[model samples]
Target: MSAAALPAKPARTPTTPSARLAWLDALRGIGALAVVAEHLLPWFLPGLRPYWFNLGIYGILVFFLVSGYIIPTSLERHGDVRAFWISRFFRLYPLYLAVIVVMLALAWWVPVREAVPRDGSSVAAHATMLLDVVSVGGVADTMWTLSYEMVFYLLVTALFLTRGHERSGLLSMVFAAAAVVVGLVSSGAVLAGGWPAYVSCAVFVVALAGVVLGRFRTAAACVLGLMAVVLLLMSSRVPWLGVAVLAVMFAGTAIHRWERGTGRLWPVAVTTALVAISPLWAIESGWWWVQADVWITTIVLAGATFAGGMALRGRRLPRVLVWFGLISYSLYLVHHPLLKYFVQISGDLRRAEVPYQLGMAALAVALILGVSALSYRYVERPMQALGRRVSRRYRGGLQRGGDTGVAGQGAGDHGVLGHEEGQVPDRVRDHVAQVDPLR
Candidate 1:
């Protein structure tokens, strides 16, 4: 559910400062806090442990919805599938690769390495970061979400390149309905574990082809289509929850399309309703179950929080919340491994005293925050700037080289989803005009 950066910045044209996307930052901050709190609070405040009302689910779902709402705009901003991929690559991979290296180094000294499945094949599969579709365990507990995020990217690109992007609402509804059906009958088994490495490797190669081979538009589109199909069909470590999550993301894209004038609000509303009601379907379908009343209460509360956030989207949040939003991605990525390491290191402290437990938990959280802040500054932010620059260069090269394809040509790259070809409404245009752009 984490994002590397916000959409590319827009040309500065001053407007009402308070009527912007600080609420989105606040939402991210809240989700980050909820997740972090879910992890940390249990260590010190064991009485608050309630699996049925897991705050982690709430936070992650919020993050997912936000991604659905905003991510498509980035594709439209670049107007080139290849450019978008390049931007995403620079935005996401460098830091991810860095973390992987760090984790591998830690394996030399700590038993933490065993947390991930150990095998040559499994290691190769994870190196691709599409482990969900490939049906492999993650290097860390949270890395599984990255695979789903990758699938969303592939699907969005597939739809956009195929000119079916405007039908996002319809597709979201279909996915939700299908998910309900699948939930009722599907065993949620792994598709096939035998060739996961090969399939994952092929997808990676084809994805690169789709990005770089602009002249072969038909082939690229076909590759994208195949990629999307494979992603949706493959097994997930989380089973039916993965399918449900995709539906929610598509619902978000539907809302973005409505705001862009490419689709209608009613369809968005309907699809969103489906996504909101999915947990009940999930529990009833026997895919998973929690305490009914408690789970229902948590779901309702999560929806209310989401609705409230959307209603107040135009309002600016406090500086601290905005700051938290800025560092949330880094926080999400780094916290779990740190938590695991400390939980072991401080085993004796857990039995020592209540005060020690509180102190230890607080200290762990503070250390995580401190490390996350530094990582955001050194890793995420620089890479984001580099991504923007690389995207621009790639687009410029395509223009100069006269390889204008489905992505659109220079100057002709009108904002297809917006009012004018190149012009977006201020609401969408103001997407990147913030102190720290919400990702």
Candidate 2:
């Protein structure tokens, strides 16, 4: 769709930074609920779960789009690789490690899934947050998405360092085209097992040190980016799907570029079409959700939802959804494990009468929301604040030390929100901090 053909941004609504971000929160809230429902219905209300589209996939796609829209902007706004990575580390890790620890602590009572490799390799992959790409399973099923998020971040950092970030539109189509070719030639991961995880973890650590310490920063970023691509293409459990997910994310970036008048909408449109069909022949024994019609429906719906959010970006969104958005990251990570534990205590509700099952589902959701809100308050919020402080200190030190490299001041673009160069709004930056690794 052309920019002119899209829905007009409502002029009457004020474009305050918070107002601009509310729609993203709303989307995150909706995505989080959809994911929770997807997990819950199968165990608690299997009869009501719709087969028309995969709710989990829908939620994940929405999340990746949101991440794509905001993440690079966050890095650009900071204009410092050290600050950006520090912010990311604190924003994502504190809660992520907590969740993993909680799950492991409970493993004696509720064993970890057999899909997870019980080895040091799992630790290595999880430490890098590149679990899926390295062919190691995460402690939580939802965590596979984090691998892609990490890959995108690495690639974006490389693009930023090399001044190639503006070619998001072209990159989107490239990934999409690669997805199609990879699907045709390869159905499964070729570089499987523990070595990929160990090697990736080592590269991730050394490369991150090089980037942050301002020693061959661009080279470090390029190496990391190349490794991310290799892992996605040769080591991911589903190579085609991995590339396609990256395509969808870059398409989101293309849409942002189009909105900012830096890019045309045609690439986004073409990328969407390509990704929709990229998985048609991806695997020999694909699940029902990946069937052509169902998969296309899910992709189209996710695109429409993002488009809808963009259209309504200027308007005030409902508060409940905004609240959901605030607690969404915690909600996303916490729900599945809690659901599994609840099922253990309550037994399967799938055989129960509809009303009884629904009541139980509602109860579970309430508990999940309550816990998520607390985690947001006690965990995510504090860690994010700490990340910001650390980022500020690092940037301040860089300025004081006259380290005017890419990891120093005034190094990145005017970010996606159209802020003046080096003048990213505090409200927008804070809101962007809440970009869930997986909503």
Give the number of the best model, judged by TM-score: 2
RMSD of 1: 8.8
Candidate 1 lDDT over residue span 164-198, tens digit each: 77677787778767666655554444475636655
Candidate lDDT scores, in order, read 0.59, 0.76
CA shift at 286, candidate 1, in angstroms?
6.9
Regions more than 4 Å wrong, model 1: 1-19, 112-115, 260-262, 276-295, 348-352, 400-439
How much is 223 displaced in model 2, in angstroms? 0.7
Please write out the lDDT profile of model 2 over residues 181-231, one tens digit for every residue.
Answer: 898888677997699999999999999999988888899999999999999
Q: Residue 30 of model 1: what lDDT?
A: 77
Instruction: Name the 10 consecutive residues with the lowest summed lDDT in model 1.
Output: 420-429
- Looking at candidate 2, the ten consecutive residues that score lowest on lDDT are 422-431
lDDT of residue 153 for candidate 1: 77
